[model samples]
Target: MVEIIDVDAENVDKYGFFCMRSKPNSDGYQKKLNWVKERLKEGLKIKIIQENGRQKGFIEYIPGEFTWRAINAKEYMVIHCFWIVGKGQGRGFGSQLLNGCIDEAKQLGLSGVALVTSEQGWLPNKKFFERKGFKMVDKIDEFELMALSFNENSKPQFYDWNESAKEYKEGITVFKSDQCPYIQDAVRNIIEASKDLSISVQIVDMDSYDVAQKKSPTPFGVFTVIYNGEIITYHPETKNRFIKMINKKNLLTNS
Candidate 1:
């Protein structure tokens, strides 16, 4: 039988968060661990599925008010990350992990469970939630805000971004947080690439979940690259790809 383990301060150091197991000693790991520690005090919850002493999956969540996504999720439970890897896929582990979140939301007396999904990127697909009875409440760009509401009258909403993107008028701006272990390296790569291409770059490290929810130019709210006040991508790309994107944007602007 696979066992689900809730990560806490006592055991967090012993197990990886299911993404950065290889680089446990890296700066990204330390940063993400610290971030998780802080969020725990604010009601963050993480559960890992262990099968035969190996971690196969994990889910991260928090009270809706502390979710990193730019949405009005107050009185709801927000899922931040959910993943089932390798042999864990297609074995009902996904449903188990999701159900764990749903059960917790019910216990907390929240309005419901909410999560952000995308057709691409690091987020989960919408089909999984839809199959579990989540409804599409809102959408921004390519992202969808889905919710399983216990209250029929309550409708959560996505944050306004049209004006937020305008905050940075020029230059390549990266809005990021330590929520993901990979973002530290991605941020470094962008900085190096900017130097090579002689482009001005701004890196905004969202130190708190509130900052991310309020200031992120994109709804994904974890890592977003904005070029000349327009979003380029929400996920990290190779250094070469980053350079090419900047060059292409420059060409179009200069043309």
Candidate 2:
């Protein structure tokens, strides 16, 4: 008896219930949810499942920028969040919600759909996606990235790294900030592993605008996986874009 419906302002509480179950009590979980709800801008797709007239579960999806690196720019779809209430499970509500997402992808004319899944241990069951024809598209350490492609011909795009120090040899150009531990670590790994490669990672102090304006500082450091001027992505869920100017080899990324 599960029925999926669109997300509305008044019934967000239902969606909140599902999200809390997915992530549980954290420092600023509630605040973050409220903020996202209030400030959601474009390309947000949401649905709620009601079983026998009772709220059972919900789902929220968006572009791949927030979830995985966007390997394909022609089109992208992402599942930002999903959950089923305690009492709603074991009653087949999960299948209904996933089906809704599939139908939604088709309706939106999307090339594919992707999501970051913590659907393991106490989170959503890992098999939840398998039942819906999704496959483990990629992985970055522990982050489980899954995707469901509607198109028959889907191949992920890869990035080529730059390895020329002719631009800045003495400035000690570090590619990351401590703010983003992943980027920081990638920088560390490259600098540390430079003994094995031709590139050296160094910390450079520059204005935020300089970082923004310059192409070398685009990959913000958190989820972006870059090394030696090449992009390393196991997750296509988030948007991983590297824009370089000609043969200069200064790479930039955002998302």
Candidate 3:
């Protein structure tokens, strides 16, 4: 039998946030764990799927006003992450979880549901959400802003990423938030790569939704790497990849 469980601050210790299950003791996991605790009070919701008795997949969503993404979705429910691992694919689990989110939006009288999709990184694809009735309202390079509106007149849109990028016009800046447990390692990798190049690095802590919505260099607001004010990456990569990306972009201190 399949089961869906709701995870809250009270039961989070029991159910976990789902991404860092294998490294609960790591800094990334601990950061995410604490972040989840604080976000729960701000109306974040997570649901996990279980097949028979084993955990298989999970989804996380939050009120648009408090979403970490660089989108204006004040009255919508913004989906942050969705994943189905291993044997969970090829089944109806994905649909089950998505429909539940939609249903909850209706129940709460939200304007609609919104999410950011991309062809790169760990985000869900636009095809799946498009098939489920989400419309592509905006586009920025490889990323797409999608929304399913309950009211036609009200919809969500992404912020001006180019304008936001102007704020970090010099040096290497790495922006990170506890929303994703994996970002801790990415930040570390960037620092290490910068060290190899003899370049100084500035790490920005996106500790609140306001900072993210206003200053995030990409649609994926949680993690970003800005090199001389241009966005080089919206997700994490290895130290070598960072080195190569910077070298290709510009001749820094050493490269």
Top candidate (TM-score) = 1
lDDT of 3 by residue, 152-196 (tens): 899898888765666777878988888999999999999999999
In model 3, the Cα lDDT at residue 100 comes to: 95
Which candidate achieves the best lDDT against the true structure? Answer: 3
Model 3 worst lDDT run, 10 consecutive residues: 161-170
Candidates by lDDT, descending order: 3, 1, 2
Which runs in model 3 stand beyond 4 Å of their true positions? 251-255
What TM-score does structure 3 among the candidates reach? 0.95
Sum up the clashes in candidate 2: 16
Model 2: runs farther than 4 Å from truth?
Answer: 10-17, 20-30, 65-74, 118-124, 155-255
Which regions in candidate 1 have their CA more than 4 angstroms from the true location?
none
Per-residue lDDT over 42-146 for candidate 1, one digit per residue giving the tens place of the 0 to 100 score: 999999998998999999999989999888899899998988888888999889988989999999989999999998889988898898999999997788999
Clashing pairs in 3: none
TM-score of 2: 0.50
Q: What tens digits encode model 2's per-residue C-alpha lDDT throughout 1-255? A: 656777655655555434434543442345445544542554555677886777677776655443222233235466655678788877777777777777776787877776545533222344778777777765543445567787757632311113322344442254432221124334444444444434444555322222321333221211333344454431212111221111134333331
Per-candidate alpha-carbon RMSD to the true structure? 1.1, 11.5, 1.9
Residue 193's lDDT within candidate 3 is: 98
**Worst 10-residue lDDT window, candidate 2:** 238-247
Count clashes in each candidate, considering only residues at least 3 apart in sequence or on different chains. Answer: 0, 16, 0
lDDT by candidate, in order shown:
0.88, 0.47, 0.90
- For residue 203, model 3's alpha carbon misses the true position, in angstroms, by 0.5
